[model samples]
Target: MPAASTGRRIRIRMSARAIDEPHRVASQLELLFDLTFVVAIAAVTAQFAHDSAEGHGLAGLVPFLQVFFAIWWAWMNFTWFASAYDTDDVVYRLLTMVQMGGVLVLAAGVPAAADHSDYRAVTFGYLIMRIGLVAQWLRAGADDAASRRTALRYAAGITFVQAGWVLRLVVSETGALPPSAQVPFFAALYVLELAVPRWAERTRPTNWHPHHIAERYGLFTIILLGESVLATSRGVEGVLGAAGAGSPLVVIAVSGLVLLFALWWLYFLAPAGDGLSDRRHRSYLWGYGHYGIFAALAALGAGLEVAVEQTGHDIDASPLAICYAVAIPVGVFLMLVWMVNASLLAKPVMRPAVILGCVTVILLLPLAAPQLGVAAVVAAIAASCVLLVILTIAPWTRRLQDGCPKP
Candidate 1:
């Protein structure tokens, strides 16, 4: 039966029930939804790079992490929820548009958020997204009888956490809380937000398609990596306009591209979609843990931008700063990817300790000689990229040597 019987069309179409399709690829609406995130990611990264270029050094990272976590968490909530219940009808599309608007508001606030002050726009944007999410959960409850209770719990939990966010915003605006109090307050709220879905899932698990969720994550990762590529190009362009494609700038640009490519290859070496399907119980670990991975990748782009600044005649880029900007994110990304791979497999597929040892060697080279130039430091990291490729190839090489059928 139709959800409404009156002559006038119902605004709530009673669409967006659980999906039943197999072999699902992301729909056009999903891709369009991701475009908003691209804007958010670009804004956040631009802020980080600009700050680092202004010599804020590591002092800028905490604020970046906080803002990034909020942005990433909002995106994750929608991704998982949509994986299970995106009906793509009129109501669903409109709510998603509202969420997209929320993303733009959030992006607009990123620069101020990075300073850990001026958070009204950011908080309001986040509240809009949370309300949009609650609507989806409530719709789910109305649409699916079997999962109504679970959906209601989700709606309740999210609504409850959103109240905490609202409180934080009010306290920040009204001076009810000191600036120092803001960190702990927001941290507590973040913890509560993270715990909600876990709490809701305990009552009854929602039907999140592992494969679809994995693809969505992968797509987001690609967007971040693309941001890295863009940053690299922008940095190179800045240097090229001033330095005229000089040797150091050219080397730095090429090495940065190589590093970005290597990270891309490393990320796709394992079939994340298949792994998620195999170990559904570990989905939370796989899903939540990716926040770090995504953040690191995006930051690495900004780091490359910092390296570009080093090529300027006026900027005196510290060797340590340049090295840290690029190397730390690369190290963190490699480590997290290793952990994800290890956790996903029942047996050890590759020796993670060996990879760690190699990464450590790569990271330490820059530290060993703090006087090293930016291009040389970038080249060292680029050399590490070769090691990763070798590691990826070794397993296939051994299999062929042993006369095993090619996978």
Candidate 2:
């Protein structure tokens, strides 16, 4: 059954929609669907904090990236596919629900998956998600002959990779492959998975709405930003627990809030939806570039959690390590956001000199960690945020005054 409205009629059917300018917006169902992913991202970031606290350091980052990539990729696949072919009929809703089930299962496995030695539970959930995607692809292929080739290509790629996941699980369980094999296995799978969409679209590209896809990415970015806020709140709570609401704790808390809001402001300064709607050719770069953005944002949260632990003296990880944990992700987020905005607008959104300068300051933070106090380090990070806002806000303000969109 089509989802109902008391005063509004709904038309839901498995029909091949035209590729022309479709007035697209993220639907309520899409937002509801994103909630599952929000849970998944939170779990992953929490696992990162736990693993980092356990002395995993940079060693744990590889496995964290592997799992995070899988989770992000799954969400991306479903979101883009829905952008093109979402009917919102009973079948479509049911298929989406099945994907949500897989997301929940995958999220449940995140902590254990961080171990890098465990494959059973994570593989199971990944297979479930891919199987659901395969079903969706087949449905789209059958429903839309114009896009049948692209849809079937997606189905074939998903099925093949899912088989590989199952094989790895079976091999590890049977002791035919050692637990150490997951690293290489995961790398190969990531490469293969990324190539599939590019290859599929070469011949028969699906006419997904550019603005809708851009908005979906923006919304997911907001979800990750919420995780950052959650991490910041946790940091404040830890500070309050250990040192009460002292001046230092208050300063740290305020710094975290400033950094969060600055990062949010920086991201929204680019008119991503308008730009993407204009230059469809850059969609691949804009889409692929966000993997780093999403991962960096999530890791930024995990890094803050580590900072909190350090501030509370809960872990003996070096001040340098703590600062690097937070700083590196922030730098990566800044770089990728710049690159994505540049691609979208076909011009630099910020002066290269200014971007290079702020990024260098962020990158140099961990080095200053050895001499600086924890509060000073956090404050420095917040200072960099202030600089970013100062540098980027002017162009946006000028554009607005000129009645032009900020790029």
Top-TM-score candidate index: 1
Per-residue lDDT over 331-392 for candidate 2, one digit per residue giving the tens place of the 0 to 100 score: 88888998888887867677778877888998787787778766678779878978888977
TM-score of each candidate? 0.93, 0.92
What is candidate 1's local distance difference test score?
A: 0.81
Instruction: Give the C-alpha miss distance for residue 11 in model 1, angstroms.
Output: 7.6
Score each candidate by Cα lDDT.
Answer: 0.81, 0.80
Q: Pick the candidate with the highest lDDT.
A: 1
Model 2: C-alpha RMSD to truth? Answer: 2.8
Tens digit of per-residue lDDT, candidate 1, span 354-390: 6788678767867853676778888889878778778
